[model samples]
Target: MEITFKANKNINQEQLLKLYNDVEWYAYTNDMPQLQQALLQSLDVISAWDQEVLVGLIRVVGDGLTIVYVQDILVLNAYQNRGIASQLMEQMMTKYTHVRQKVLLTEEAPDVRHFYEKNDFESCDKGSLVAFAKFG
Candidate 1:
């Protein structure tokens, strides 16, 4: 039940990529190029493991000193509701609070919204600022 934070450059990309696919929040089913880009953008990431088994992960994409968007905060299905995500967010906050531009996007579901709130996020009103995405 130990959480370990490591820079993406220091870890095995293949294992970390596998963890990314294992998350439920992964929307694209077959987009290797995009996935690689996503991995490259993550300045800070962590893998939660019980010994050698990877159970959860958190990734942040942005310039480490400024805008960090927390993405793919996930824990295995069996590991849900156990404060694992909370702990991951807590770790991120502790490490990057001074960045002053921390943000995360959640799916359009009540449960997802609740999860974000519990981790100290609130709904923002960005009038006329549309958020866009593409799935391949």
Candidate 2:
């Protein structure tokens, strides 16, 4: 499968909803307008497409200099295990190599941890850093 990557915020609501829903991310799919607005205002967005089908996406939000927070990285269930997410991460990392800090929060899972670790991200617990988050 030839997957093409694009760095742009021109994705339609249907594509966003389908991609998120495929990954069971109902939290984002629940509010279409909010999600769309969030992506539109993101620092950067990289998407993978199989021809015309949206298969994967990775988006970050930050000031683009001191810090960058990877707000979301997801791939369609059928498209997992194919290195699409890794490619997205590689592109994002390359784009922000000058940034001092790169941060992301994800569910606590062994596979998830492995994926991030493979991508060169260290867990806060393993280092001298600590992370805190409060959800509204």
Clashes of each: 0, 0
Best by TM-score: 2
The digit string of per-residue lDDT tens for model 2 on 3-93 reads 9999988798999999999989999999999999999999999999999999999999999999999999999999999999999999999
In the range 53-112, model 1's lDDT, one tens digit per residue, is 666777888887988888768777677788877887888778888897888766676488
Best by lDDT: 2
lDDT of 1: 0.70
Q: What is the C-alpha RMSD of each candidate to the true structure, in Å?
A: 3.6, 0.7
Q: Where is the poorest 10-residue window by lDDT in model 1?
A: 3-12
Regions more than 4 Å wrong, model 1: 1-22, 25-29, 32-37, 125-136
lDDT score of residue 36 within candidate 1: 58
